[model samples]
Target chain A: MPIGFRAFALAGTLFAATLPAFSGTLDEVRKRGNLVCGVSMGLLGFSEQKPDGSWTGFDVDFCRALAAVIFDDPKKVTFQPLSALDRFDALKAGKIDILSRNSTWTLEREAGLGLLFAGVNFYDGQGFMIRRDNKAVSALELNRTRVCVQAGTTNAQGASEFFSTNSITAELKTFPDGPSTLRGFETGECDVMTADNSGLFAERLRLARASEAVILPDIVSKEPLGPVVRNDDVRWYTLVRWVNFALINAEELGVTSSNVTEAKRSTKPDVRRFVGVDGADLGPKLGVTADWAARAVAAVGNYGEIYDRNVGSKSRLGIPRGLNQLWTEGGILYAPPIR
Target chain B: MMVSAYPALLIRVGIPAILVLLLGGCGTTIDEGVVTPGALTERPATIRNEQLIGKWGVASYRDEKDRKRVEAQARAQCRLPYIIAKGPSDGVMMHLADDAKLYELRIKGGSDGKTYLGPEAPPGEWQDREILSVTDREMIMRFVDPEVHGRYGTFIYVRCPG
Candidate 1:
C-alpha cells in the first residue's frame, strides 16, 4: 500500500477505536459492578498485598475511595497488579479503569501514551541513602562518594546531575535492579544508594541494619506521582480528578471519618457542602450520588488520614510529610475550592 | 443602492460595536478564578489605601444564598463598623492568616492579572488574600492559605452608608 493510504487507514482506525470510550467509562464501570484498578505488584507503604489476599496501601486507598464514590462501597473494586513496563499498555488495552500505581506524571508518558494523570496524589523525588555512621547530613556531604543506582532507571542520571550541578564529584555504581542495588549498598560496595525517596523508605525496611542507614533530606528530581486514566473519557477523567481533590479538600476543611457525621450537622457552608448537606448538584455533576465525597471520606478518611495511615509517621515506613504537607502548613499541597 | 451601502454601514457602525462587545468579553475573562501557579512577575497593582481605609460592615459566607442575609447582617454591623485603618506604611492594615496583630498589606498583581492583598511577599503567599472582586460599595476577599480559607471562607465588606 502507498504511504499516504497507510497513514489515512491508521488515522481512521484510531478514530474508530476511541469512539466507544468517549461515551464514558463510568457507565461501563457501573455495568461491570466494580472498579478495576491497576496497581503495582507490591510496593510496601504505597501498595502491598496482605496475607488475607486483600491489598492495602496509600495507592489502594485511592481506588477504594473511587469505588466508594461509584458504588457507595469501598469493597466494590478489583485490584489488578501490574509491572512497571506493562502498566500503561494495560490501561490502553482497556484492562483497567484507572491505574493507581506510583507512576510519575511525566510529559512524555501523558502525550506519547494516550493517558491523563488525574492529579498528584504524592510528591516524590530522587533521593540518596547512606550509612548514618558516615556523619553526612545532606547529599552535598557525599562529595567523592560512591553512589549505587539501579541500571536503566532515572536515578543514575539524577545523581549525576545533582553532583555536577553542585560542583561535587561522585562515582555512580550500577546494579541490575532495586534489590541488587540495595544489596550492593548493604555489602559495602558503595557509600550511598539512590532511588526515589519512597522506594528508599520501602527498601530500608528490608535492610539488615535498617536503623543504621538514613535517607538524605535532599530531593534531586521532581517526581509528582498520581493516578492515571485513559485520555478518551473526559467525564471519567473529571470524576477521578475530583475524587483526589475531594480528599485534599476534606483535609483542608477539617472533615474526617470520625467527625464526618457531626460535620453534616454543622452550619458552616463549606463544611455543609463537603458533607453533601449543601451543594447537592456537585456529586451528580461528577456522575455520582449527592453524598459521594462524604462516602469516600468515610471509607478512606481524608488525604491526611490516608497519608498518616499508609506512609507517614503512623506507618512502618515512617516517611515525613515533607512536600506532601498542605499548602497552608508550609508545604506545596493545595486543592481548589469545592464550590 | 441600500444593499450596496449596507457593507459600508456595517464597517462603520457594526465593527466598532463588535469591538466593544469583544472588549467586554475580555474583561470577564480576566477573573476566570483560575489559581495563579507561581510568584507574581508583573508590576504590583495600585489599590489606593484611601479606598480601603473606611468604616465598613463585614460578614463571611461560603454559599451564595447566604450572601443577601450576610449582606444585611454586615449592613447592620455598621452601627459599630469594622474599621480598615491606614497603615503606617503606604499599604492598608490587615490581619494575616492565624494572626492576631494587624500588618501592612499592599495590593500585589499576579502575572495572570489578578490582584492580591498581602505583605511584602509574592501574591498568593500564605499571608496573602486574593481580592476576588472589589468595588466602591462592596469588596470580597478570600485567603490564599487553604487552612485559613477552610476556616474563614470568603469575606465580604459592605461600605457603611454615610
Candidate 2:
C-alpha cells in the first residue's frame, strides 16, 4: 500500500477506536444520579466558581435547568470546567454529558467534529471596548487607534477583517491571553480592546475603573453560543434542545417561576400544554415525566429570569438584552412551541 | 373591489369590539403582557382578503425533502379542505401558535413591502406570519416568531379545485 493510503487507514482505525458506543446518554445520566456538565474555566457572567466551591452564571443555570427537568432538583449536577482546547475532547470522550459552556455554533464545529449544538442559547458577536474618556461612539470612528486583542482567537481575525473592509487604519496589538490583553488595554498600551461582546462586558467589570469603559454598539461577527451534545444519542440531544426551547417559550407565555403554579390552572390551550395540564404525551416523547417543563420553570424560572439573574440588567455586568430579548419584544431569541 | 370596501368599513367598526371581547374573555391574558404597542402601518396589503376565502390544503415543512413531500401532501389535504373563512372584519380566520380557537387576523402590509397576516397589531409582530409567496394556485407562509417558525416550519397552502 502507498504511504497516503496507509495513513488514511490508520486515521480511520483511530477514529473508529475513539467512537463512543451507541448507548443512550439520557439513560447513563439517570443511572449516574447526576448530570456532568462541561463549562468554561472562569468566565464571569457565563461561568465561574466562587470561593465557596459553588458554580454560578448563565451557563451554570442552563445545566441546572437540565437537572431540574430530569431529577426535579436543580442542584443534581456537577460542573466540570474545561479549557477551550479540551472542551470538545472532554465531551467526545464521554467525560461530560453536556457542554453548557458559551461555545459558538459553527458549521466547521458541527460538521468537522462529530458533535451537535442543541440550539443557540445566546446571540453574541465580536465587539470593541473603549474608555469613556475617548468619547468614540462607533467602531467606524476608531481609525488610527490602537486595538488590543488576544492572540490565536477569532476576535483578532474579526477585528482585522472589519477594519480592512471599512478602510480603517488602526494598529493591531496581540497579547498572549485574556488577562494579558486586558492588562495591555488598562495600562495604556492600547486604546481599544476587542472580544466577544459578552466577554467585553465581563472583562469591563474586572477593570479597576470599570465605570470608565464602554462597550460599543457595533457587532462585527456573528457568534451564536449554545449547549453541545455528542451526535450519537438522539434522545439526549432532543431533551437538551427542548429544555432550551421550554425556557424560551415559558418567557414568551409569561410563565415565570413565581407564577408557573398558577399557570398550571390556566385554561388557555398553550399555557395548559406548557404546564402539562394538556399534551401530557409531549414529555413522554422526550423520555421524561409529563411535567418536565413545569419542573424546570418552577426551579430556575424562565429564560428571561435566568438571563437577568446571571448576566442581564439585574446582574452586576448590566449587559442590555439587545439580541437576547424575546422575538416578540425586540430581539431574535426564539424557541419552538411545546405542542 | 366593492366587496373589499364593505369589509374595510366593517373592520373600522368591528376590530375594537373584537379586541374588547378577547381581552375580557380570557382570564389569563397570554399575549397581552409582552407585546409593546407600536405604530400601525398604512401600506395596503398586496393580497386581498377576498382572494383567501376558498378552501386550501395546508401543510408545513422544515427541510427540502419534507418541502417536496409536503407540497404533494398539502394538495392531497384538499380532500378535507382547510377553510379560510372571511372574518367579521377586513381579515381572515386563522390560528396563531398554540391557539385553541381561530382568530380574525388582518393582512397587514409592512414598510419592507412584505405582506403579513396577524392580529391588528404591528407587522412582523410575534403573532404575525409573513406571506412568503402567493398565487391563484398556492400560497407559502411562515411565522415571524422564531420559536413558532422553528417548530411549525413554512406552511404551503394549495387551493382546492372546485
Candidate 3:
C-alpha cells in the first residue's frame, strides 16, 4: 500500500478502538429496585422542590410516569436535582438512570453529547425581560449592553445569535445557573437576563418588584426539553419513551387521575385495556406488569393530571398547558398509541 | 390575495421567534409578597376586573363564548366581584384581560404562581404614551407616541359594580 493509504488505515483502526463500550442500561434498571431520575434543582413551573424537599413539577411527573410503567408504582423513583451544567454530565456519567430534567434537545446536544433524548415533553421558547424604565423597547435597541445568561445552555447561544441576527452586539456575562443569572440582572451587572420562557416566568418571582420588568414581544429559540439517557442503554430508552407515550395516550383517551378508577370500570375496550382492567401482553412488551400504566395513573396521574397538580394554574408553579396541551385540543402534544 | 396558513413561515421563522420570546431574560418583580406595592404576587389570591364582575350583555369581547357565558351568569348570581376560578392547565388559556396599564389575564393552572407586570403602566408588552380610555362594557387602549402607535380596541369587561 502507498504511504497515504497506510496512514488512513491506521487512523481507522485507532478510531475503531476509541469507541466506548456499550451496556444494556434498560436491563440493569429492570434489575435494580428503583429508577433514578434526574430533575432540575428548581425551575418554578416546569420543575420545583416542594417545601418538604419532595420534587414536584411537570418534568418530575415524567419520571414518575416512567417508574409507574417499569415497577407499577410511580412513587418508586428517586429524584436527583441537578444544575444546568451538571444535567447532561450526570447522565453521561450514569449518576441517574434517566435525566428527566428540562433539557433542550438541540442538534449540537444530540451529536456532541453522548446521550439520547427520549422525546419532547414541553415545547418552549426564549424571550427578553427588560426594566420598563430602560426604555429598551426591543432587542434591536439593546446595543453595547451587558446580558446575563446561563452557561452550558442554549440561552447563551441564543443571546449571541439574537444580537448578531439583529446586527446588534451585547457584552456577555455568564452565570453558572439560572438563580445566579437572575441575581446578576438585578444587581445591574448586566442589562438583560435570558433563559427558557417557562423559566423566565418562574424567575420573575424573586424580583424586588414585579412591575419593574417587562418581557419583550419577540421569542428566539425552539427548546424541546425532555427525558435523556445514556446512549448505551437502548432498553431503558424504550421503557422511558413508551411510558411517555402511555401518558399522552391516556390524556388523548380522556382518562385522568381523578377518574382513573372509574376508567377501570370503563366499558370502553381501549380504556379497559389501558387501565389494566383488560388487555393483552402489553406489559410484557416493556418488561413491566400489565397494570403498570394504571399504577402510574393511580400513584401520580396522567400527563394532564400531572400538569394540573404540579405546574397547573392552581399549583404554586402556575404553568399554562400552552403547547404542552393534547393534540385533540389543538395543541401539539401528540403521542403514538401505546397499543 | 389572502395567504394560506403560514406553515412554512411559522416553522421556518415563527418557531424561532416564539422561542426567542420564551427564552427572554430576567426581570425584577413589579409586585411581589404579601403587601408589596406593584407586587403581582401580592394581588388578591384571585383577580377579576372589579368593575365587570356581573352578568351583562355580551358584545365585541375577548373571552370565548362558553367560558364567558358561565362567567356572566356567575356574576349575575354571585353579585359583583364574581369568582371564575381558572380551570386546570390542560386546555385553552382563556385570556381574562390584557390591559393597557395592567394586563390581568387568567389562564388554566392548578395554582397561581408568580407573575410579572410588564414595565409600562397601560399594559400590553408594547409601550404607549397617549392612550387612555375605559368603559364598563368595553374600552379602547392605544398609544400615539411616534415610537409606539397601536390600538387595542373594544375590549369587553362586564359590570360588577359593588
Better of 1 and 3 by TM-score: 1
User: Which pairs of residues collide in model 2?
Assistant: A335-B147
Local accuracy of candidate 2 as per-residue lDDT tens digits, A1-339: 122332243342233334344536776678778899999998767887988888888899899999999999999999999999999877877778899999999988888887899999899999999998998999999999999999999899999999999999999999999999999999999999999999899899789988789999888899999999988778899999999999999999999999999998998999999989899999999999989999999998999988887887667777888888999998999898889
Model 3, residue A56: what's the lDDT? 69
What are the per-residue Cα lDDT tens digits for candidate 3 across A220-241?
Answer: 7888888988676576777778
Please identify model 1 stretches exceeding 4 Å from their true place. Answer: A1-21, B1-162
Clashing pairs in 1: none
Error of 1 at B93 (Å): 67
> Cα deviation of A312 in candidate 1 (Å)?
1.5
lDDT per residue (tens digit) for residues B1-162 in model 3: 111122121133578666655443212223431222232232322223342223433223234454466445534543433232223432111222344332333311112332222222322222222113335553232222212231232323344443
Identify the CAPRI category of the predicted complex in candidate 1.
incorrect
- Of 1 and 3, the candidate ahead on DockQ is 3
Per-prediction interface RMSD?
A: 35.8, 25.3, 17.7
Q: TM-score-based ranking, best first?
A: 1, 2, 3
RMSD of each: 25.9, 22.6, 20.0
Model 2 docking grade: incorrect
Q: How would you encode candidate 1's per-residue C-alpha lDDT over B96-157 as one tens digit per residue?
A: 87778988888887777778888876676556888888788888898876556756878889
Ranking of candidates on lDDT, top first? 2, 1, 3
